[model samples]
Target chain A: MENNKIKIEFLSYSENEYIARGFVSVFASTFNPSVSWLSDVKTAVSEGVTNCIVHAYPNEIGKIILELEVNNNYLHINIYDFGVGIDNVNKAIEPFYTSKPNEERSGMGFTIMQSFMDDVKIESALNKGTSIFMCKKLLNSVEE
Target chain B: MDIKYTVSNNNLTVFVYGELDECSASQAKNILDRIINDNLNSQKVIFNLSGISFMDSTGIGLLIGRYKKLIKHNVPSYIAGATPATEKVIKLCGLYNIMPKY
Candidate 1:
């Protein structure tokens, strides 16, 4: 398949998380992914956006940019937030490691993203922002 | 998100409608907590996710949060009606360790 791309910008509000998931799922549907594959993509997108809302802009609203690109059968997602950045990306990705334990945070956001997607990468700096890039290989919809 | 609670005998079942992502987690948390508090005397708490269309890690936090609240009241929590998609997430997060499936 030819490369297709789309970008979305929205406020880092909890409500927008659902909208982000919906946008990505719809964009991915063009690939005719299976039901489980589509669900995995949606879940990964939700985790990425939720991180921006809950951790990136914890105190105030900020802008979140979601970009989707399809190359061949691979789906690429980039989620960005210009809010308080993570102090440690390695520790943040650790399972059960949460910065906001009191808020019932399971600290599984990054873990979930990594699990659902084949590739996950993070770049962030304190007081600046964070960007998470993920990719997943969608199963071919056309039968051999 | 909409939440409905049903009490039968000593068990309290909470039905969740809508996606259980970050958008609805906070509201669901408050509502579920209130329901659990109001029924502290109940022996168990069950979360019915048949109506849940989608869920992410936020759902895990919501369930774990409720599990903590119920345990404080000496009540246990169980999961019911989780779809395969939601169940995959639940198992990935090891939520069953705290709140087993019923």
Candidate 2:
């Protein structure tokens, strides 16, 4: 059972609270991260998910898939969106960088994700899509 | 997020509450800008973070931007009421060196 992984996908709509509920419910039990750590992770997750809704499709609709896997005391979360892909991931991570500055975005979404998570991996291609793969290690959990 | 503005003895204070992340940062920045512009001659501007429950990197950005604006006019900036977790993030970001957290 340790080898098996669980994945949850939700539609990228403003009304969908399932993404947050699903993520917190699963990670709360699996990692038992500190409250501060949990809040950081949750905020980062919410920011990424919100970006998918605001940036990915523009006027069109899309889906966001959150895949979680536990491996060797580390939890991996992959948030994937098949919408308009990022042209430059580096620029996106830079502080005060925002493509939608007109919308009053602080442009620190990627930076917060990088700052809070242990590891952050982003993969994207123009018009293809963007995927963020993040990992956090459980201080108390041991390898299976 | 909840934002409150108050004036105490010639000083303008802004209290930031709740989570201030990428989404709500602009509001904070804009409000601060307005206060600073309105009180350009005021010497002290205090940001009370007592009510803030969660804050991320965006919070740091918001604070830094305000610091830059206030510094241009020789106004002193102060921070107070940061929780341990919030304080940790502020320290880790080296903002304490720039804007001392009281």
Candidate 3:
């Protein structure tokens, strides 16, 4: 397999979360992954993008960049947001930890991403922005 | 997202269709709440997620929020017809602790 990459930039709106999921799922389809694997990828992408729309730009809309790369059997996803960065990355990732509990946020976005992806990383600077990098290993790739 | 409900024998069942994500959750919350409130006399409530094609933590939040609302009225809630994928998320988030799957 050869390396492939795609990049998308869009507003950090709740609706774009679905687009992000669709884009990554379609990209991962090139590997002929199983239905379960594709669903996992889509769910992970949804969480990453929702994080940006809900938490990143809580006050106003901002830009979000989604980058997808396929290398061998691995699917790499990078979701970047230029909004109010997280004040505590560690606390933010904790299970059931939410900055906006009143909004009915489950605070499981990062947990879902980490659960579905093989690797997860977060980089953020207060008043700057936050970027989430996630990678998933495609197992049992159906042969053509 | 589209939400339809049926009331029978003092029970309220909400059927949700479409992706349950951040974008749809707020809408779902409002619709579900209204239905549940209108059917407050019901003894129980159920969420039919068979029509849902995708769900994430936001979906979990939506369900949990509704569960909290129902519990306040002494109306218990159960989840029904969730796909395996959605169930995985529900279980991972411990939503079953509050609303059991039927």
Q: Rate the local accuracy (lDDT) of all candidates.
A: 0.90, 0.75, 0.89
lDDT of 1 by residue, A1-144 (tens): 578999999998788887888898789877778888889989998998988988899989999999999987688999999999999999999999999877888889899999999999999999999999999986872343
- Per-residue error for A85 in candidate 3, Å, reads 0.8
Give candidate 1's error at residue A125 in angstroms: 1.4
Candidate 2, residues A13-121, lDDT tens digits: the string is 7545334534665655755667776766676676677678777878887988877777877767788999999989899888668897655455767877788779999
Query: Which parts of model 1 have CA positions greater than 4 angstroms off?
Result: A141-144
Error of 2 at A15 (Å): 7.8
- Which 10 consecutive residues of model 2 chain B have the lowest summed lDDT? B19-28
Mind giving the per-residue lDDT tens digits that candidate 3 earns over A30-100?
A: 77878888898899989988888888898899999999998876788999998899999999999999999
Look at candidate 1 and give me any clashing residue pairs.
none
lDDT score, candidate 1, position A26: 85
Q: List candidate 2 stretches off by more than 4 Å.
A: A1-22, A50-62, A94-108, A142-144, B26-38
**Model 2 TM-score on a 0 to 1 scale:** 0.74
Candidate 3 lDDT by residue in tens digits, B1-102:
899999888888899998999889888898888888799989899999999999999999888888888898898999999999998899889998899988
For B1-102, candidate 1 gives per-residue lDDT tens digits of 799989999899999988888878778888887888899999898999999999999889888888888898799999999999999899999999989999
Which run of 10 residues does model 1 chain A get worst, by summed lDDT?
Answer: A135-144
